[model samples]
Target: MPSDIHHPAAAFNRTSFEACVVPYLDAAYNLARWLARDDTDAQDVVQESMLRAFRYFHSFHGDDARVWLLAIVRNTFYSLRSKAAADAKHETFDDEAHTLIDEAPSPEARALISVDIQALQAALENLPHPLREVIVLRELEECSYKEIANITGQKIGTVMSRLARARERLKAELSSSSTEARRHDVR
Candidate 1:
């Protein structure tokens, strides 16, 4: 263990948690929720993460608690994922905005997108967790490479590589879904 791990402040202190950590609670909850995808599971993971963070607060320093806490949330989420394996298969989504194939889409196409955000959410929910997280964090959350690496415990290089791959996979998925929609219309 590092020297910080041995300090009294590293052990347990409610005031420390309140001062250094309370501000980040929501961010922790959000990251955990995104990774876990169920209200109960997300809450469970956040609680576990906060407890562990309290125990290890000495190891935390500087002004990076938010990213550091998110890393914990990510790890806790993965542990729960392995143990439970009965939750939503999480997926990462991209931030590329799709313009209306035409703003003045024909009634038929309007009917298609009338399915709207719900259909998009369902499609996002269907993606694998790795792809989903990368897409959500990178595109939706608009996190920088350093921030992502800090939260994910991945090397910045790995983040970039995985981010590129995640975008490619999401592109493939949307392309296929669009094809299917077109096929349905032709029938």
Candidate 2:
């Protein structure tokens, strides 16, 4: 049999897809991780999302690949979440007893950042999903309101409102945590 030769158009499409999608993998993973709240699940979501993105890449004509890819990532996460929810009904898992162990930080790293980082992370994680997503997209991902609206399929007004609410809640949580820490210090 003769060696199979690549079609020029197929080669171009593959190159274009890689160029557009590869650079934004980190951003996609970050968004998925924040939404899923688990590293393994986030990785799974990203992998599935990449497949979806590739399958539908021909339809993508937008200028911002990051926003487009993030939209796919967010949708993939929700789809997985829905399936997990359905599965959860038939299972009996005690989340409180299921703990995840994080890698230990160096002593100096812990001393410099651990307390504050942990508090902030906890606060972010405690926010409602809508609020947490807006925070991650706007602040951490540095996405503009228009970008967020496109990714979330929300109106611009809704995106702005959610972001404002998320910021206020974060401020309140951080302030309360700081006060509690100060009290412990005084004690």
Candidate 3:
């Protein structure tokens, strides 16, 4: 067998894969982070998604690479989530062994984050997964409705409806949070 470096087809595939997929690694990680809601889990999801993309690179036509990659990322996250849920069912919960701890940030660390930013992040986190993912894709990643529909495997109409609902929910959450904050300030 010839070495891959000397093989023209192999070299071309590798180059094309790098050119199409490597530039979107950060975007992939951001989507995963928002979906998984945990830094370590998001990193793991991105790693698995990249491996899947590389394995299936040959099947990829000359379409939108970002949408393709994000779809894979979204699928991988849901797969892992489902598997984790199944695994949790078999585990025994021990109250003593799983004691919760309060991990509040230091005052300096808290001060570094803007109040409005924190409230927004908290509200986003509180949204259901479906709404949250759509909001993150459209608002944060700047994906169009068609791209989001492709990434989410939803119809364009569904994507639009979800986005509208997510926006309204976010507005209500932000308004309530600001009101509470103002009350605290006045006290």
Candidate 4:
């Protein structure tokens, strides 16, 4: 019986890649979904990112797989966005129609869910891409400043500044929303 040593390299590659990258799948998909703003687009972006990561896995020498994977995801998203931009024609955005509204869930449904995830999602979505990306990386992904800086290819100072601005914007938006809701309730 001849032992198959030829398949060892393939097994090693698959195992190592899985160990390094599998844990960050959710984070990658979340970041992709946020950036792409559509489940289908996000899935596509994540798939592309994974393919690119596997192809260039040899270049990955870092300790933090999440940051590295996120960096790839971010780069892939921007590349897709850039390509879309190049192909884009005139398209007018209707702000009024697209504005996020806080709709009250029915009494039965409200009893089961307490937190309003949609409002936060909408607030984050309304932020500019850079600001939103920083917030998402820091808050949602729970990445450290240095990790975010590395992933974003920005200085730590820039990441901190963007995070600060993102927080302020989110606060203001949420506060204003609450105030409007209160006014509506009093009417």
Compare the candidates by TM-score and give the number of the best one. Answer: 2
Q: Using alpha carbons, what is the TM-score of model 3?
A: 0.80
Alpha-carbon shift of residue 61 in model 3 (angstroms): 1.0
Candidate 1's residue-wise lDDT over 28-69, tens digit each? 787776676666677899999998988787778766777778
True lDDT of residue 46, candidate 2? 98
lDDT of each: 0.72, 0.82, 0.84, 0.80
Please write out the lDDT profile of model 4 over residues 50-162, one tens digit for every residue: 99998788788958888999999999999988888665522233334334444586654442232234456668878988998999998889999999999999999999999
Q: Which should have the higher lDDT, number 1 or number 4?
A: 4
Q: For residues 1-187, write the lDDT of model 2, one tens digit per residue.
A: 5423397876777789999998999999999888888777889999999989987888999589999999999999888888785645221222333333345966554443555666678778888889889889999899999999999999999999998999899899998888876655521
Q: Which window of 10 residues has the lowest lDDT sum in candidate 3?
A: 89-98
The count of residue-pair clashes in candidate 1 stands at 6
TM values, all candidates = 0.66, 0.82, 0.80, 0.80
Best by lDDT: 3
The local distance difference test score of model 2 is 0.82
The CA lDDT at 27 in model 2 is: 97
Query: Across residues 67-149, which tens digit of lDDT does each residue of candidate 3 receive?
Result: 99999999999999998966442222222322333348664434333455667777887888999999999998999999999
